[model samples]
Target: MEMDEDPDTLPAQRQGNIIITKYEQGHRAGAAVDMGHEQINIGKYANHLGIMQETELPPIRALEVKQRRKESKRTNKWLKMFADWPKYRNTKKLSQRVYKGIPLAVRGQAWSRLLNIDKIKSQNPGKYKAMKEKGKRSSRIIHRIQLDVSSTLQNHMMFIQRFGVRQQELCDILVAYSAYNPVSIPGQRYSWAMYPYSAWVSPEGVSTS
Candidate 1:
């Protein structure tokens, strides 16, 4: 019953039961904790990025801790899988694992592998940088891209600012892609195509090459 145990190792029924128990406990205690001063204290330290939050209720905090622990266990599993990717790559088990969930820590790597990004980069060396430079020189689509960049993912904390880091990164990817493939139009649709990839992958790993 310890929260520290890896839920992934347990039987499906057992894992469900444990989560349900924790949720019920949190539900029962949620009202009492909301009426106390603990809510104010927890709210102050809560992460604005929404990655992690300390709830006002102790029971809910406990549930969150349990969930975080579960995610950590899953992340460790992914680390092992990534370490032996060749063996597991293109396997049904890999697909099942992805269907189960990809932990945020390894999500970018998983996506990169799935998309064959590294292979593409290898095949076309220096192409992404060259396209980026080309994108810079092209003024035809830059205005259209600029107009859509600010509105894409506007509510998300990372893209809230007019020209924030993530927004800029997104813009760069779209610009580069537009330049790399002139047939593709640069617009809101292109923003949607690059937004999630830019959001998940680090700057160094991301490319439209």
Candidate 2:
């Protein structure tokens, strides 16, 4: 299913110190939504579990409203910056903004742009799919990866269920990476290495190439 044309306009709600954005689902149930050019089935989980919550410091009621307004203004500025990133990519202003902090709402997009994900994907077309297929055929380290995938981030709601969507994605990534780099045997630490990328870009956005 296609994703919302603009996730930026999605409704956001505050729970405790966490801000959760609600993404609309597609026509079909359990269909994956495109996020930053990657098919990730986060909409369902996000709606039910608030999976994409961004944490913030606890503030007083008035301060919380003030903070939200401040953040909203910053978010708008960042969005404008994203439209013409090349203009500010290496500027001191960009560095200053980064130093201040990237808004949680646009962090995923910001990370993808900063890391030049599109360029990497273009240079190595179909590599992820190829490695994933290779991973399915290869069996040397599958058992080890399976054992560690569940334990990597089990505390998080996204990975809490045994062999759930997120866990399977993690397993697929490790398997694909193992295939892509034959000499590297993925261990528990390898899962950790992939976690940060997956956290921001989703598993599909991770570049094994």
Candidate 3:
């Protein structure tokens, strides 16, 4: 037990005149291998669930989320201002707000208002239904729509399943558009498809219609 004596050089055990040998277990290395194996198993389990084993957010993404939350106040202000949008009639200000980018939560409503989607629908009553009815008669068009629908957003929840409601709706919409315009028939070699964009007018006074 002298301070200068090396512990490794000392005898492990002494019983009367007999010397007992000591064996050290390699527990550290064994534990490390076990941990690695457990990690692999955990990863396999996560894959079975179709998700990641860990849900930790990266530093950059966490910062982005924080920034997004901080910027939500601007979205709220715009929402309140848009309530009486017609009364103010400020397209210039609205354009500025759009250029800054709208929040994901309010993007749909904001774009709808900007594009006057309701007004457009009102102008062409039952147009969508009429087009859809015409599309139902074209088997070729339906087949093409089904083929494309199957591949659309395969990873997204809305379109992941084949023949899902969203996929069906998508097929209906695309087919309806194809039938709505004779030039863009599904069997046509090369033709322009006239859709809602056809109603849009550019600043240069050019109309797509």
The local distance difference test score of model 3 is 0.48
Residue 190 displacement (Å), model 2? 5.3
RMSD in angstroms between candidate 2 and the native structure over all alpha carbons = 14.7
Q: In lDDT terms, which candidate is top?
A: 1
TM-score of each: 0.62, 0.58, 0.56
Please give the range of 10 consecutive residues that has the lowest summed lDDT in model 1: 48-57
Q: Which stretches of candidate 3 lie over 4 Å from their true place?
A: 1-61, 185-209
| Model 2 misplaced stretches (Cα beyond 4 Å) | 1-60, 185-197, 203-209
Give a tens-digit lDDT track for model 2, residues 154-174. 435566455555666666676
Residue 204, candidate 2: alpha-carbon lDDT: 28
lDDT value, candidate 2, whole model: 0.56
Order the numbered candidates by TM-score, best leading.
1, 2, 3
Find the 10 residues in a row with the least total lDDT in model 2. Answer: 16-25
